[model samples]
Target: MTLPVDPDLRPVSVATADGSGAHYWVWGDPAATTTVVAVHGFRGDHHGLLPIVVGLDDARVVTPDLPGFGVSAAFDSGPHDVDAYAAWLTTFCRQLHRTGDRLVVVGHSFGSVIGAAAVAGGLCPDALVLMNPIAAPALAGPRAVLSTIALGYYRAGARLPESLGNALLTNPVIVRALSEVMAHTADPALRSWIHDQHRRYFSSFADRRVVVEAFEASVSHDIGEYAARISVPTLLIAGDRDDIVPVAAVQRLAGELTDSRLLVLADVGHLIHYERAEPAAAAINEFLARRLGGSTSGRP
Candidate 1:
């Protein structure tokens, strides 16, 4: 769905502990009582979450291009593993949070894993929303064969020379193939837009090393591993048709969390942010209202 008008977005940047700059965009009112930090999936920037941001008119939304993606610089030290990303997220939220603001974390796909890890590691947001969360190992999912092939693809990209590796990783053909596989929508226009979106932003990573390391991190961990440790009320929005993490896995993840609600969308696949943004946002708004008692005004 196209937004009637572009949301007013303000660009902001912060220096992380690792010395890399975390670049982000702020949407909605700055003084809004609720603040949301929306994290995008692997190889994507802030643009992936814009549809949700547009629907969340009552809260201030912060969409960050995680370190090593989009305009953000890569970490000066350490591998781009779950722990490193969790630490970076902790520092990023702490720096952006303010007095009297209710902070909420919204993550999609790989970002959901990062959010869960960060929350389990002591990044305390008032509430958490995970869209298309990685609730099970990619290798164990129904798409295991694809996952294995992707593992090798990333490995080859990492080992190749810089120019060749970048070319292979960012190839339009491969990006479109991945997009077509994940996008379950039947609407031709929407499917085309999804492919275009992937073609546009799926290769914005800092370098081959960062993308490969991030891919390893994405496949290495799942939200279920950290669910029991998370104390905050959480919302899990899953596409029933998701091939990466099945709906059953997400239900199991909800049972593992201390307090969580699961919403499964029918006929939707892993590309909920692209195909089912309106429903996802509606659920998120309802969750925030019920759990955090925030404003529902369409002020933004």
Candidate 2:
């Protein structure tokens, strides 16, 4: 699971419209012609997308830790819902956007929903990339039963005492189990690394309230809700074996988008950023080159 190193990686922080401090990392050459703003999945930080960033060396990639996650402070106003997140993303992109850069927005899992919402709200980027996007309602997906179970789990955690709620939510055993379920890799080394990553960063949320509210937001909405409103060229990289959102769902989502291409990876699951970063990055590079007319010299 070792990834390519980025010597230029640096930390950055910016104040958002909601008065929350948005902490992020900038990777690759700052002078690169293309800039990608990457949003990580629920309960995850920028590290979850570093593998993909490693492969995207030709473009500047900015990975942000969404509000209430990692080092980013929670929103000072409004609930942690889809609309609030979309507004925050819009502000973040505007604040970090550089002149003469081909801006792109990339999101994974829950982040995809937020990205789509922002685009629908008029945050126009050169192109959009959704990795393992929740294309359909989780309650209607193949894993509806599991989603229902998770709903109860989050509800129980939210109803308990603050300390106990955080304890249940951050339990290492549950985190490993979730990681084991999402990760389709058979390599013991990679599986162990994925598990270790979850154990380390999955519980870094600001508090139980944020976790519960974000989970609710993640499951309540899907990318399809805003697919029609997204006018920019879009790229969807989905895993055929993804338990969270199957390839069929992603295909449907692609059909809904006005301008989009779908790339399905076989033998991969929900954790594409971890298990299939190289191939995913290859697809992304090709899509960007075609849509933005840029050179992908080191792609793949």
Candidate 3:
């Protein structure tokens, strides 16, 4: 799953007042008047959104590696929760946005929680797109038990010697298992690519404390409160096969939002963008055009 980097795309860093910075990839003209800011989910980086990026045309896109993942610095100040992330993102957007410029904010998985918080906190993006939004932890059936076991194991692993814990988390077998569990697609090629990506990048998140804290924060708070307050037009994408964030929860979230439309992908799962990038991107493009009044055609 090696993607071609756009010739105009380059790595950029946005420094915070606290001396730490967030790193991201930028695509399209550097001086574009409108920007799409995409945030990756838990255990993901800018690479996770490459397929979606390919489908976007006619606008500048910026994808950031949230605080503790990818090449970005860890959140050394407050808890890695929605509120803290929203605050950081507000600053990051302010740095990128010029007067009279338009913005569309997109978030995947846990990133959606942060996006909702940011909008509720008055970040003021013109449109919001939430892909595979997780309203709460999937605490049903065997998956619930497995999730509990995984958390317990993580807590125990954290207590081991630092080197031992890191080695345990980064083990090839464990990484492969974790990656496979995140997907529901039957496409062998796509599954293989996802496993490889997760083994190489997702499992290599070096900060154990940040990993545990972020995991806890992801399922702790309900985004419904923020959803109710969000005034921006929103497109909510859900995968019917998503075990972690079921379509039922997504429907409930849509009901809670002030203005939104929910799209359920029949055979897709948590990795909506990865499994169905073309359709995902098309859906996003349509949303941007119809809801946000942007361009009609998208990129290849």
Candidate 4:
């Protein structure tokens, strides 16, 4: 089946506790019995998960640009770490959905870190879907050591003046290389779009401070800790060739979550939802059917 672009996606804003605005896009039935909050990964906006959003049928799907990315303003109260995102999510949910609503959270990459933390802290979504989740970023290894160093650099760079930091981090060559690393699909058109998105959005952050805080949170986070505590029905999607979060890490994460199952996709990479949204959405839709009882067909 051919995937449709999420035509129902409409921009909406809600006030944070401190009265600042948080922007998000919503798709599907607004008053649906189930609501799926789709959280994008680091340096990504709502559009990143368009495929998955388009395929959602019987539930409302929300895509928000975590503070300091996309149209949302920088987080005002605290650091842009995992805890901060979780807190922000709690506030965001409270503002939109009632205190007790059937919420199914779908998080990708870094966003999964926030979701896992929220679930552990008792946000208690009916169903939790983690796509390309970050498992044990702090574990010891060459990759871990490199990640630590890179995060350290971001922390220090964030301390620098905004102009200086932007100049350093937003260098054209560096941005291009970063985009190239993520454009791993075999399809030429999708690969080109990925490169374009990296150039336009992923490489740029609204606040340099958010950059440092997000990196510090992402690298320091250990998903296994939160995974073990997640009591909600959970589904994990892992790309076989995922370079950022290795498939092995995802396998271990599945083992940690008591009620979780892992679905590994072949010939795919870190940009699982972006590159293979159909299959990604299909998996999520099917999972939701079993958990929430609904068809996958929807108005996109």
**Candidate 1, residues 1-300: lDDT per residue as tens digits?**
675245234456555555788888887787787889999999999988998888885788888889999888999988999899999999989888887788999999999999999999999999999999999999878878989899999999989998898899999998988898888999999999888888888999988989999999999899988978998999999998988998999999999999999999999998899899999999999998888764643233
Q: Candidate 4 at 263: error in angstroms?
A: 0.5
- The TM-score between candidate 1 and the true structure equals 0.95
Candidates in order have lDDT scores of 0.88, 0.88, 0.78, 0.77
lDDT of candidate model 4 versus the reference: 0.77
**Tens-digit lDDT track for model 4 on 1-300?**
133454234566555643446778777777676778889888777777777888777777778878888778887667788887887787776566644457888999888999999889878777899998988665354377667766766766677787887776667787778777765777888887777767777754677777777877777786786876898889999999887778888898888888887899888888888787888888888897877655532223
- lDDT for each residue of candidate 2 in 1-300, tens digit (9 for 90 to 100): 665454234566555666898888887777787889999999998889988998885788888889999888999877799999999999999888887677899999999999999999999899999999999999877788988899899989999998888889998889988998898999999988999889878999998889889998998899989988998999999999998897888988999999999999989999999999999998998898887775743233
Error of 3 at 53 (Å): 1.0
Instruction: Quote each prediction's TM-score.
Output: 0.95, 0.95, 0.91, 0.90
Q: Each model's number of backbone clashes?
A: 0, 0, 0, 0
Where does candidate 4 clash, by residue pair? none
User: lDDT tens string, model 3, 86-144?
Assistant: 88888888787667767888899888888888889989998889998876654443367
Q: What CA root-mean-square deviation does each model show from the true structure?
A: 2.2, 2.4, 2.9, 3.1
Pairs with steric clashes in candidate 3: none
